[model samples]
Target: MQQSPVDGLDLVFYNVPHAEAPAELTFAIPSMKAYCGSEIVAHTLHNLYTLRGAKVRDTLKWVGYLDQALDHTQDTEIFFAQHHWPVWGNKNIQKFITVQRDSYKFIHDQTVRMINAGMNGAEIAEAIKFPETLDQELSIHGYYGTLKHNARAVYQYYMGWFDANPANLDSLPPTQVAKEYVELAGGENAMIKLAQKAYTQANYRWAAELLKHVLNYNPNNKQAKDLQIKTFSQLGYMAEASTWRNFYLTGAMELETGAPRKGVSTEMLLEMLEHTPIERFLESMAASLNADRAKDVDMVINLVFSDLNESYQISVKNSVMHFKAVPKAENVHTTLTLTKPFFLKMVTGQSGALDLMFSKETKIDGSRLDLRRFFSLIDKAPGTFPIVTRK
Candidate 1:
């Protein structure tokens, strides 16, 4: 769609309909390559699988967007993206889009091909590699999304989480495995000694790995924690990608000083709540429920948002929370009415139940005890929860 607000300028929009991918809406000027952030880029490979976690992107739909941009902007002279500088000249623009498109397609196709050929995720990741001609290009280098992770992402996208290995199907959890490893390796002191040796040899990767095992087994091990801090710092300094470098450095900082006790900002809380669906929010609440604490507790709470004109009925049964958009007011233990602003304040720690009740911001229509019990079942993660160090 092209919209001209002025006499001689038109902004054209290009995005895949009903699909989640980068540069949800990109603008294009006539005879200029569209500025597609992740859809099409000039330099540095876009994250096919985002580092911070998101929905799996549709590679086919992403490629389709690139094709649409190409067909519609045939007279383009140069292109630019949010992540990097511009690529000038028609030949270079064509080549950039072509390479970017093919890179994603190759990863998706080859991963599926290997899957059909009986190769699992690890094997496919090890086997897949871009041709030398493409890999040598500075534009699509593994600065963000490494080939290994993207390959694994593709496999997981197509074939779900289970790898069909019976042994892996019922393996012990991380803490259990860590305890076993510590015992088998002669305890925390012995593990720390080995990690120190690895650190001395500049094998920071192995050092970090070993330290994680120790921390999991005995979180109070000061030696293990200090060594992990050093190893992560070294790893951060050596990383090329900004995201990778930042994460590593942050991990080290948290290990040394603990996670910050900063609360969510008003702007951030609003943004998150605005984009998140009601169903997803309820699902997250369900996930965060303290099952052991709520084993014998059951309650129904009807939440009515006055500002948004929306209502949801939440029911807890078997220590799991279930919610629906339409109100099921019947048999409800309590019905709480509050505006979006008040709800935001309460959730972000700016206000509490007492403030809401005292200020009449949130009106409680039924048993306050039921609401109190429901709230107590939701575990409150400490503001400065551990990250690099064990919890």
Candidate 2:
């Protein structure tokens, strides 16, 4: 019999700890302490782009964990975290964790309170304020995540992008709106003069907005672009949060010069895709499908992964693609049998339909034309589209 990876190793797995009782461990060290923080009680909430925005419920859960730690580690002399410095002395540790926990709760409860009062994300962001108890604490200050943005994030987590305004529900795109705004402001020159006045008054935010409208209406307007770049630089310098600073600076860079040619390497991308399930790839492909092109066509393709011994039936109808992992469909317009690696290559553009048809590693059965048609309907995104300016 073969021994598994942990066959001879001692290990302990436990369920999540509750506020009433926490999972405890002992270590031979001078200071008897606990490491209570993880993603929750960092110096600030470093909210990155996950599938969904960061949730206040998660923050509240961390507060519960902190409560458990406080209850269980009464004699603990030190406390540490995943990021930043550690706290020493039981009294100081207690104060630190208590403030950190309350700060999140404050943001969450207050945002909800304002939301219930009929205020939208932007309104709540500007209106919400922290009590002096949490506000005066340096540990919970917005170094990575601002209270303003987090307030809005909490709003988005609850209410989504819509702010309950009927006019905003179906507004024109930014370019068209900019054209209207610029014309209303008299002309491009008038817009620039207003932006210059705002910049002179050190109101970079308003200046940036006006310049954005001018540039959106005419991207090649050199004067507007230059002023916008300067405005972005000022905003970047003024930002307290590192994320906001980086975003503003990056926007300035992209506007002044073109977007950088560099991006994630193909090898790195393929490695990431390798770990992702085939269902997600199919979903992404469906999302990228050109609906206009596929509206008049209907096709079905059977994909067989010979190495993985998995097969899926994919059907396109009414400009939408539906996929299922089942026995190969008898009515499939095309059947392609290939290894997972070859399939990855095809999806990533390293291999085309001709390669699939001709390669010794793949076997194709049924209509080649249908297979080609399927690939053609999937739009290929340009890797480096402009961000701060018109493409």
Candidate 3:
């Protein structure tokens, strides 16, 4: 609407439907978010990736609104998305919006088609590339998101979180698997040497690929360190996702110099915690636990937040931690009474909820040493990670 006068065409910000439009093309992101301002449509597209697609597992129904985003696909000569830009001409805009809205729709629809046809998300994503004409566009690139991930999300939208494989239901996690991979690959040094050879052979991609697995298990190995540096350089030199480029570059930097995680904002964490599923919070805590060191230690801490009127009983028995919310009926160990913001900090180790022990902010009836030991039990997953392969 703020264009510098296009042939004296009325610069009307048309909120009218495509059925009413007599314009070139209509562009939108389907929705909007931070970073990309209004007028440009953007979807975070993370949940788009996680749920359904991987070969290992599938996801269940996505409870979010899909139609609310897609229904605005009418009345446009061209539609410009916020992340990229707009495509022009009535035919083009209609096709573009239809393609995109239908892209999510197709993945959702055709996936059920394929799922009924006996294919999974991984199988479907591999088979579901858009036509060459659409795929050629750089804006449709898999910089931040990929077809594979999106397809899986659609699968999750219907089937729920499961890969239909029992082994994966209770299988070893990524880090544990990575550790075993390192052992089988004749240790980190051997893999690093292999990665170096690949890098030297101008196979920067393969080198980066092999090196990440080595680093995942032994993040501090000198050879793994050096190879990853080269890999980041290669990725940074070629990446289109500024965020992806930054993730690779920053991860490389952190490997050389162990950068401690600066805590996520307390307000944001509290907002997330207050409404997030208790299971998800426990999963977050499980991700927080240092599985390598989590052994025979067993303990539990009960916390009560007066403001929210909630109580949680967390038991760390046999190194596995369990957290559940309930009424504070019987006192167990520690009763940390604090605001949600302080509790978020306590979980992340940025600040303490147990500071009541010293600050006189609240009351506590648990062992001080037990509280400290409990804090030591969990591991923190990183906010971002490097992509080993480009797809």
Candidate 4:
């Protein structure tokens, strides 16, 4: 029985094909491909909001599922994965499963071994190598997930961003450091010349790095910006991984023009958020609170959703927001009662402070000024920001 919700609801279903029955056909969802790298690796290596980094242990378990299927389906004449073409013949199927299983295990075990030897993520990434048995096989080649980045991901999974170097414990921000670097390199012109030299040598990575420092120091430097765009294009063309290529090319595009104004539609966003639990939205609001603005304020507001019959207590103290789902607090400075639809409308900006203050359906039981103060502490984000250029 699957423990979690298959499609947002708990389900119980019998597994077809008893263990003892001969299996001429078998199907398996490749969880290893989802977590590890498949035909294309997802751009989740350093994204903190998602899974953060690949969970090596979970990856192994996914491959183990495939291995288990292989054991049960020894007589299976055909095997197929959800995303790939089917494999025929039992021996061919066995080889395919074994190769994939070993590939994931190899990455996990080898990365951990390097971690124990006092090598940091970058160093481990540079030194790790695949054996000929795995290297020669096209099935495990890094068309999607390169060995270099995946090894670094494994390091990130265990050690995090810190490399134990005291000098890097609290380094300056990138822009500040970039300014210092440009000044040390004898100004922007000299940096551009150096970057030009690297670019001429087809050392696009080094050229991009140098140009990045130049651009960071003075985003208006036309010479540096043009060269950087060229460097990004070259790097993008050279990248084997589609994700890396897309990122590099997109960086160039953003630098040439600007970030695209269009994004996910508001209606689509609202629909997605509607299905999400209310606590998650509250958490997002807490994260969006401006700590500096809220430091001097302390407030507790009770939120009552009539449609859901739910009450939550939200408190801000010492520049931190805390939430709890319970009955309304008697000591709360204010209580606002409304339906879930109205609350969501407020969240998505379909409604605003004026709407909240004047809406006929919304009931305000305490000081409206305190409610306004609470809303003021939360900062509004534009949803997109400059990536390759400074604000």
Best by lDDT: 1
- Give the Å shift of residue 379 in candidate 4: 1.8
Report the Cα lDDT for candidate 3: 0.58
The superposed Cα distance between candidate 3 and the true structure at residue 368, in angstroms, equals 6.1
| Alpha-carbon local distance difference test for all models | 0.76, 0.76, 0.58, 0.73
Q: Candidate order by TM-score, highest to lowest?
A: 2, 1, 4, 3
Model 2 regions more than 4 Å off:
1-36, 48-82, 88-91
Encode model 1's per-residue lDDT on 1-391: one tens digit a residue.
Answer: 6554435666666555533454467667763444444334547666656778886667777777767766655667767776667777777778877887788788888889899999999899889999888887777877877777778888877887778988888898767888998888899999889999999999998889888889887777888888998999899999877678888989888777766877445555677776666566567678889999989987889989877789999988897888889853767899888887777676666787677666677788888888878877887555566666554
Which ten-residue region of model 2 has the weakest summed lDDT? 19-28
TM-score of each: 0.85, 0.85, 0.54, 0.83
Per-residue error for 369 in candidate 3, Å, reads 6.5
Q: How many clashes in each candidate?
A: 0, 0, 29, 0
- lDDT of each residue in 1-391, candidate 3, tens digit only: 2223335533333232221112222324322210111222333222355321333212222211223323444444444444455455556544444444444555566678888987776788789776676566544566665666667666765777677878758887667777887798798878788888898888877887788778677665776777788788777767665555777787677666666455344445565666654456567876677765768776767777766777888877666777787776464656656666565666555665347466555556768777767666765555444333211
Model 2, 1-391: lDDT tens digits are 1212334543222233322123422221223344445444556644422223333334455556656555544666765655787777878877876887677677778888999999998888899888887788888777787788878767886888898899999999989999999999999999999999999999998999999889889989999988988999999898887878888988989888878786544655998878878889889889999999999988899999898888999889999988999987788899988888988888777888779889998988999889889889999775677778764
Clash count, candidate 3? 29
Please report the TM-score between candidate 1 and the true structure. 0.85
